[model samples]
Target: MTYSKLNISTPSLIINKNNLLSNINKMNNFSKKNKINIRPHSKSHKMIKIAKTQLKYGACGICVATLYEAEKMVENKIKGVLLTTPITNIKDKVRLKNLFKLSDSFMIVIDNIYSINFLSNIVKPLRKKINVLVDCDIMYIGKNKISRTGARSIKEIISLAKIINQNKYMNFRGITAYAGDIQHINNYNKRSNEAKVRYNYLKNIIISLKNNNLDPEIISGGGTGSHELDAKSKLFTELQPGSYIFNDVEYNNVSIYKSNNKHFSPALIIGTSVISRINKKQYVVDAGLKAISADSNLMPLPIEPTPIGTKYSFLGDEHGKITLPKSSKIELSLGDKVYIQPAHCDPTINLYDKCLILDENKSIKTWNIDARGYG
Candidate 1:
């Protein structure tokens, strides 16, 4: 169904198709030129259409954060599904085994021997080899340790690799060393240096693994913030940068190589309507915590009818306050729509079931968030 700007409903997620294509093409070209593989993370959009487009534009595979996302991708015939998180529970393991049987190529990350043993026992009976990548924590040490799921040291990483190589039902595909803390440092030089530390650690782990005669086919880990650094390091064979497809306000703050450039444009926004006016300068929007996420502690930026010097603030679960200049020329009626850029795209996209794909001519198409609410 085609929709014009005026007719679009409020509190709807909008995707500028032109900007989306531009981001996809730019990242794809970067990966090609650098001779590295991009497994664009599907957790950002969770739509099979975007996944297909990513693969069409030279992505080697798709990275899913959950088994449910992987199942959806495999069901749609998308090849090479990688579950970036490990499955520890029995029920999830059973589901993973089932997915392994159904998918042409299926993979998961393992940070410890317990997960490896658990996975090995389940797949051993089926005689099916499940591709496994060791998750390595290569980020800097914090006061209370970085709260991420991965092997904390080089020894643990190599030990996990050894277990995977020894398991008959598992294939040591590579390593995943993503620095969530360093991804949004807001300083290019410092972020690159921190990423370099992680890269060196990843290299050392690889060397130790090879010393034990274990060769990894793919080293997967990288985000939108460190994509350039990862590509330049020439260490990782596979790079997973999810949020680049839909650049949000959170990623917009990072000062990486192509971040400030037009290479990646903000394509995702929530089309909200101004419902109430408080005084002459302040108004309430339809989007709030329930509609668009404010977990990043940043308010949504107004896009459509973007008046200069307007500010958005979260009021409550069902309402958001926008302050406009009293002397501004932009007039807003009760039903005027205000498109807002989400602070964090991943979780914000999860709040909606479908995304409104705005075409180049400003028409709209509907793309279902097929992997939405999937664990």
Candidate 2:
């Protein structure tokens, strides 16, 4: 249906069904053609419907960022759930024991020998093996001072893999290294080149692992921004790109979007209302720091129903201001609604408990953001 048909509260999270499905199909089509598996990251949507939809579109399974996310996926009967982060807490280790027992296809990523030994102790009593992968640090080391997780070097990753293989309670499934830092690089050539560098590094690691008889069956990494070159590289057995389903402003700037007859579009958005107006050039909407997330210090852009060249910024915790150009003659009255494209998709989606999903047949449905919070 249309935007006006979405009858919901102010600053509500909205999903365009056609756009969402198109994105899923596009990613799936690319992976299938390239002969690689796609494991869509559930952290972006964190809902049952979206996960199931991805599986329906031929996704191998789902990738979760937290233990809670894995629990929810297994609890709902979603199989082949891969925990991509190296969880450290003892309580979560305990949680993993239960979660593993529920789904034999469950797996986790680890980068340390201590984590392996600790998990081995936890899983010893279960009488079952917990599957795991080695998180490799593929992010550019010299590019930034702050570091991302994974084994810092190939030697360390091999050592971690060996420990996992030796541990009776753990099964060494594969290696995972997400270049998250490069996902939003504005230049396609630079992003592709950097990803290739990481790919070559990983290839050498695989050779080393094979030499040690620790050959991994799975090599998982890649994001939405580098999907085009990622599938072509023929390195990653399965790709995990979360934000493709919901094209946010950050992705809009960095990602090399294909605008053919079929492609991904900005499906997830915030619908806000013009609560107050300062003049013809400026107005206040109900969404702000609370409604839209500012994780990368990125501001939301005004989607249609709002004019072009309109700017949006967080005014306060509960409000956002939108300013128009000086020459613009458009004047929005009070109570008028505006649909905005959020800057960051993942955390912005977590702010809401439910989203208003609009269908092509003018149907408005609400879906719970099942894995919405830290819990």
Candidate 3:
């Protein structure tokens, strides 16, 4: 049905369907052209259909941050589910092994020998190996890998790979280095240079693995922040970009390209209704701190119920205020439908169970954020 017919409540998540598809295709096309495998992270949209759409657009697989997400993907028969985090506890270890039986393409990453041994023993009953990747610490900070994040040093990472290769229950796929700390670097030249160094460091590590006759078949870990560089770099065989599918205020503000990026448009927004007419320039909306994410330093950008350039600000947990241009002729009334693009898409999405998607015909569709709160 058309968006106008539905009684959508204030502070609801909305997705522009055409923009979503276009963003997906744009990233996919970029990956194909650069000879990099696209494994879009499910942590962004977290919807089963969105993940499926990604696969349909040539994503080699789906990367999930939690075992629960992997289970959901496997349960839905979504192939190539890669759990980016390491499985530590017995409960999750068992869950990981069970996932192996369900999906042949299911994969996990390891950062230590104990986890390797833990996973190997549990999955042995299945008499099959689970695809394993070594999580290399590439924070590129401190004196060495130990001082940084991830799986310590090059020696430590290689040792994990060696153990994986020795075990019949583990398939040593490759190493993964996700620079979460570096993805949001504001300066384009700085981000690019930093990524190049990290990729080179991983390259050396890859060479070391090759010298030991354990050349990796899959080197994963490129994020939305570094996808362009990641795609061009010969280091990562596959990239797990998350945010590009749904651009947020932070990602769109000259962060990746060092200039204003017109590549990806915001597909997600919070649909709110005007509740109070405070003044001509200032009015309160129903969306506030709880409705949108505050993790991002910047506030959500107003996109609807406006004359262009309307500004938004937080008023309370359940309220926000917007300001129109001083000289504007337009006037806003109570009960006006308002939409604003979030500053951070991932965590903001986790706050909701479903999103209103606007199709090409301007009709509204609802897709559940299935992986919400799946720890």
What lDDT does the true structure give each of the candidates? 0.83, 0.85, 0.84
Candidate 1 Cα deviation (angstroms), residue 284 = 1.0
Error of 1 at 236 (Å): 0.7
Give one digit per residue, the lDDT tens place, for model 2 in 134-164. Answer: 9988774536633677898888988999988
- What's the candidate order when arranged by decreasing TM-score? 2, 1, 3
Model 3 accuracy (lDDT, Cα): 0.84
Scored against the true structure, residue 363 in model 2 reaches a CA lDDT of 81
Q: Which should have the higher TM-score, number 1 or number 3?
A: 1
Residue 272 lDDT in model 3? 86
Tens digit of per-residue lDDT, candidate 1, span 1-375: 123255788889889898899999999899889999999999999999999999999999999998889889988988888888878988787787788888748788988888988888778768778888898877645323575888888778778888788777878888887777777787888888777777777788888888878777888888898889888888889888998999988887788784566447899988888899886778898998988887896667776465767788898898998888666876677887777788999999999999888887776789999998857
Write the residue-wise lDDT of candidate 3 on 1-375 in tens digits.
224433687779988888899999998898878888999999887889999999999999999988888888899999888888887887776677789988889988888888888888888899887899998878754223333336867788778888899998888988888877667777778788877778778888999999888999998887888787777777889999998889999887646654446668888888888899988888899988889988888889887546678889999899999888888888888888777899999989988989988887776778899888857
2 or 3: which has the higher TM-score?
2
lDDT of 1 at 58: 93
Model 2 collision count: 0
Better of 2 and 3 by lDDT: 2
- Give the per-residue Cα lDDT of candidate 3 at 37: 93
